[model samples]
Target: MPVLVNSHPSPPLHIDMTPPKPIIAVVTGTGAQGRAVSRAFHDTGKWHVRVLTRNPAGKVAQAFQKEGMEIVKANFEDKASLVKAFEGAYAVYSNTVPPWHQSYTNKLGEYEQGVLQADAAKQCNVQLILFGTLPYVGPEFMGLGGVELYDAKARTNDYITSLGLPAVYISMPAFIDNVHSWPLVKAIDGGAKLEFVGYVVKPDKPMVFLWVERDLGPSVLAIAESFRTFGRPLAEHPLNHNVLPVGSWRGTWGQVSDEIEKQTGIPTIHNVLPSVDQRWHRELTKVFHYQNTHGLFPTDNFPTKVFSSLGVQYGTVEEFVRTKIAPMFRKS
Candidate 1:
């Protein structure tokens, strides 16, 4: 049985007051994507961000503390600890990754962690939640193997919906920064060798898309704001559960290979499936092949349009990739 932390007597509703500093509790806020998004939310100064981590005093937690973020120790595997972490939060930007020690390809650990977070948040009276999820057309049209990241997220979505809480779920196609998954990055100075598996059987030319991470934050914020207006639209009122694909301008893998050479001056090579055998690399290759075959393209808007309508101004792929990611290569 889970311990009750802050149960309310009334029906679940977002109590909009003078907009007192928004408290956003982010689970696993120390991770790459979580840290970046939390920093963006904190920079606004209107948000009071609290991070839930197993090691609250570790390097990542310390870094966030220096930035003035509240650190709370909560292990999702422990229900009581998670309950305590969600005690007083207005909204939560939630993410959970598999344990580093785990060797299994299917990330059931991350999936279970998210389920615990959602259950704990519901008990704690959180008004809104901004959740990260993989693409799914319900359970019927699942993509990307429908296991590990995707299946876990789909389960979490079901859990949150059953809680009857107002939630905004964002489905990001793929990260532009996933280039780090390549093994060649280990040998190269500023460049990484890119590879894709699976056949690209399409009328359109074969291509690969890389998503820039910096563009993710503003779009996430936009989704968060949309949750504020959630439930105003009836369930039958064509609720917008939109999917936003984030990548640099759509072009051939050769174009991306050329851009890498131009930007880093390091040779970029694209290898076919047989040449690439790394587990993570193969997973990414599958995603690229699927999206290309499906003719997926990056949107022109910084923040996706549906989210933008909810008042989020998104950043562009070139701007983020050039500023945030490009500097890392220079530093390397």
Candidate 2:
């Protein structure tokens, strides 16, 4: 005989909860690129943002922490710290500062740090590793013999791929904000008219440019979303999976200068030097030569389909100057 208790069903249970967001660990989050990535993920509200920085008390780190994101103190030189910081992260964005900027004469330091970060990500079992990389212009390339910066990034790119961890390489070209740092801008600040200098490349030679602060975050977010939607199998996708060279626009120095004049109402003059003889010029000349000859990433093409599918819009140089650059100059 079965004993049946008249147990009336209690009130229907009501529980509402959303799934947890994916965790993204951003290395060197105190810097420009890393900070942009952190903000991007934060804005989406789709991922939990954890930033790894050597200086957790730094201004930028504090700002990020105040935004309710996790801040983990980790040094690039310390692999253990990186591994610990990377633990439980679904994806990791690793970017290393140039050695010269850190007062180190050795260029190989960038490559070493990149490898260390990649190894940590692998150990932590990160599903995706996005490396900030650049094209390698080696000695084998006709005009790029002395460009150590490009070569170092190229080596790091190779090392990241060698790890066989699901990875995406984001290659940033020259930043449009660099115009503000140029001597020409300094001269403008000193009440001189805008006078620009172009090295080996012709005035009409097109150069790829990016507005890092605005574009980087959106670009990274789009990439992450693409990875999630397509899954790990897309890592082996021939076109969309591998390297993404990101730039807002492409224009010649002449066109850039013209835009500056049009936006600021200040006439601009540009000088194209026939050859570079100064040490700085000589070093950079090789880079320009390589860019002109081999071209930066085959006709300055970007992953259009990926960006379009993600509905991410990249800004134009004119728009950047008018909206972002002009305001600063106006204030000054």
lDDT of 1 at 153: 72
Give lDDT per model, in order. 0.59, 0.75
Off by over 4 Å in 1: 1-20, 99-108, 137-145, 180-212, 226-253, 265-267, 274-303, 310-317, 324-332
Pairs that clash in candidate 1: 176-210, 176-211, 303-314
lDDT of 2 by residue, 207-289 (tens): 77777778888998888887777744755644443777887777776787777777766666787775555624454567678
Clashing residue pairs in all predictions, respectively, total 3, 0
Candidate 1 at 61: error in angstroms? 1.6
Best by lDDT: 2
- Work out the TM-score per prediction: 0.70, 0.82
